[model samples]
Target: MTLPEKPASGAEQPTMAELAEGYASKAGLHRSSNGNIDVLKSAGGVQGIAESVLPGLVFLVAFTITRDLPVALIGSLATAAAFTIARLIQRRPLTQALAGVVGVGLSAWLANSTGKAEDFYVLGFFTNVAYILAMALSIAFRWPFAGLIFGFIRNEGLEWRKHPARMKAYKIGTWVIISVLVLRLVVQVPLYFMGEAGLAALATTRLLMGAPLYILGVWVAWLLTRPAPAPADPGTERS
Candidate 1:
């Protein structure tokens, strides 16, 4: 484990996009499957790697690089839970509720403190928030992103039979993120020795990248569920 295990510090992680892509692969009519067995399928070795650990490590990596504001880490989890509440309002999943809080908090963060209301840094803050939220949603809800692979399946990918998958993924994501955090906190080894300036650059870039990554991830998820066509009409129904 390292210092970047938490969300606030893990901006420099390279795999954030990769890991997030898995979840993003299931959007719209193609949400993550509610099959607890599938998620737990990879319980040993390869499966173990996929289910028990990798997910959290990915988050920790992002959290590690995105380091700086401890508040954002708490913000990440709080906002996620908040999103679940929002979904409950509309009868959606916890991820939807998490999205709401993310949107609000991030929109505000993006609003900027440019000494005047005139300075609307729209792209800077909100974009970053969006990216973090996309990845965070997976963490918040606890599901494995099967990408196009899972898309072929019947269930739109959403709705885990049990909420246990949510906790498993969350714990896994959080654990890995925590490990990265330990490295940064204990050894104080940064991706780059940006000192104050380098560290600042890392966070800013992460915010910038977060949006596009989210868009791509969501888009891919949709493409996977573009809707298979029905078979040709049969003559039997010609009454």
Candidate 2:
């Protein structure tokens, strides 16, 4: 019996490379025809931004007007559901919508159980902290997560790890990302602790910082980590 055919030599890539490609794919970054990173597409574009921000915006507005937790929660859930339904109608992927639903549902549950509106933002803090620590660890390991992502997007594959300059650029990019998360906490955590009184401010900051700030931070990181163009060949004749 033929031993299971050994995988083709070209198909034999390290598992880390495979994982990094998958992670980068999910980042939604794409190169434009001119080879610039499409920051809006990376942030999911207009549809993606609306999907992420609208539910929270709805909840905040509803809570502010009615000052009723259940009503605000229901409004948020309904907004999330509406996006899910829209995706279904458009035959679009439901991953973003469904994730939004789950997040809003969890936040609603937390706030409802504790009978404090501020708890809705608590889970976000934990999530940010988790990301900060994970990215920090990746930097410490010299496997800066930004390199994994940018390398994949730039078609450099995993070779960036072998180049010290590229590795340093990616590390700085990763730190730029870490700073964004840290900024979110620094600006919002105080508002979160202010309890319901601060709910409005907390929710406002969350909306402002959610997708817009993320896009800005990622754009900056992408710029900072971009590879320098190769020097022009002196022997090449000009047209």
- Top lDDT hit: 2
| Per-residue lDDT over 1-239 for candidate 2, one digit per residue giving the tens place of the 0 to 100 score | 77787889898766654554455658666556665677777677798899999999999999899999899999999999999999999999898899999998999999999999889889899999999999999999999988877887777878999999999999999999999999999999999888888888999999999978977888899899989999988778563
Candidate 1 lDDT tens digits, 41-85: 221223222222222233234445664333333444454454355
User: Relative to the true structure, how large is the alpha-carbon lDDT of every model?
Assistant: 0.38, 0.87
Q: What TM-score does model 2 achieve against the real structure?
A: 0.88
Cand. 1 TM to true fold: 0.26
Give the best candidate by TM-score.
2
Q: What is the lDDT of residue 16 in candidate 2?
A: 55
**200 in model 1: Cα distance from truth in Å?**
3.0
Measured with C-alpha atoms, the lDDT of residue 25 in candidate 2 is: 52
Q: What is the lDDT of residue 209 in candidate 2?
A: 97
